[model samples]
Target: MEWTLPQWGQLMTLFMIAIAMGMDAFSLGIGVGMRGILLRQAILVSITIGFFHTVMPLAGMVIGRVLGLFVEKIAVMVGGGLLIFLGVNMLYHARKQGEAGVLRDLASFWGIFLFSVSVSLDSLSAGLTLGLFEADTLLTMLLFGWMGMLMAGAGLLLGRRVGAWIGGYGEAVGGMILIGLGLRFLL
Candidate 1:
């Protein structure tokens, strides 16, 4: 089968967006890692973040599809708006770093789950925007899940070894990516 330029471009865009989405988990994982975590706990947290990244985006896509059905004409604008909002929110949160105190109980299932959900929340919004555009669901989910886990694991491992210098920058980069994507949609 032959591939077109637009298809390749879309694929690249999705891939970058997926990585950007995972940056949240990466940054937070770094904080947790700096605090010192067991290898088992890190694995558990990474896996949980991956699961939530997959599921949350899928759920958002479902909701976005429903919304698109009702407001097809304005769906793109709405998606753009949502992305911008999410991006701004991420940036806002990134400024308030050094909150690792809140994540002291990451050894438990609930702790892992809550942390995963918190990190993956932006994926949900991004998925909603992609859904309005009718993106490839399978690819999006896979990229999100894989990248979320991989980035998070990297962050946790790095955090354990390094200082707390790269704390919130990952999230800041992710926020910028989202904002750029949102502007792309708008224009």
Candidate 2:
């Protein structure tokens, strides 16, 4: 491909989208990391999240590609709505419990899996939107996975350092990020 200005713009947009999607993982990781996980556990959790970040979007893209044939025009809207809903749900939960319930155990396989899936749900919606627009799938997936991994790691480490100060507020911040991104997509 020629890597034109439009392509560059698309790539930048994709990168932003990846970060937006990863914020959930990052925020939730912070919440979970507050409980003091070992380095090994952190690595395992990050890897699991990275895997889900890639897989969920790939699945969404496939579904979106198939759905595009029928609802092409509204796909972006649907994707935006999904993000908003997820964001709102996160905020609600955070406010209700003031913490990520059941996320305290990062050492367990199912705990890691559930956390990974919860965080990656936004990527799936973003993938659907990108698929609707016929974006570069390989590039999108790569960026999503890369950003998700890096962000999750950073969040965990940061949480270990400052999680006590922020406490449960990290999830609220993360929820706001998602809502902002969703609004950006909508407008």
Candidate 3:
């Protein structure tokens, strides 16, 4: 397959995009792990994030196809907005000295699933953006999933070890990074 400019751009952007997208998972993982989540919890969290990274983009593609071009643009805008919102929310939460409400609530599968969906919404929309491109959806989703897993892994691994050194505040910083990246897409 002859790679178009967009596809090439997508390839170049994939890693950075993944890193940006993964920030949320990383941050949340850090917070969750620091609070003593186990190895099973970490694996499940990463898997859930990975699952959403795959599924959400496909859904985004479907929405883009059915919802028309204007809606597709709207999807990107919405995704960007959500990224910023989540980032700000994380920073705000940082000021508070308690655990994340989501972490407290995520004692079960359903709860984690919900969290994964919520965080992966950006990736879902990102998938839509990728879908809009004349690029390979499978490759894009795979890249996205791997990146998400990697980011989540970093978070969990770090969280387990020295998260307390920073009082587990890396998540807020990660959230800020995500917000910046999301805003960049809009611009």
Best by lDDT: 1
Worst 10 residues of 3 by lDDT: 97-106
Write the candidate numbers in order of decreasing TM-score: 1, 2, 3
Model 1 C-alpha lDDT versus the unseen true structure: 0.87
Global lDDT scores for all candidate models: 0.87, 0.77, 0.68
What C-alpha RMSD separates each model from the true structure?
A: 1.3, 2.5, 3.9
Candidate 1 lDDT over 1-187, as tens digits, reads 9989988988898898898899888988898899899998888889888998899889888888888899999998998888888788878778887643446579777888788888898899889888898888888899899999999999999899998778889989988888888888999
lDDT-based ranking: 1, 2, 3
Pairs clashing within candidate 3: none
Q: What TM-score, computed on C-alpha atoms, does each candidate reach?
A: 0.95, 0.84, 0.70
Model 2 Cα displacement at 41 (Å)? Answer: 1.0
Candidate 3 displacement at residue 136 in angstroms: 3.1
Model 3 C-alpha lDDT per residue in residues 65-146, reported as the tens digit of each score: 5654556547666656655775676577655635435453456988788878876877776665555543467776787788
Separate clash counts for every candidate: 0, 0, 0
lDDT of 3: 0.68
lDDT of 1 at 78: 91
Using TM-score as the measure, the top candidate is 1
Q: Model 2 — which ten-residue stretch has the worst lDDT?
A: 163-172
| Higher-ranked by TM-score: 1 or 2 | 1
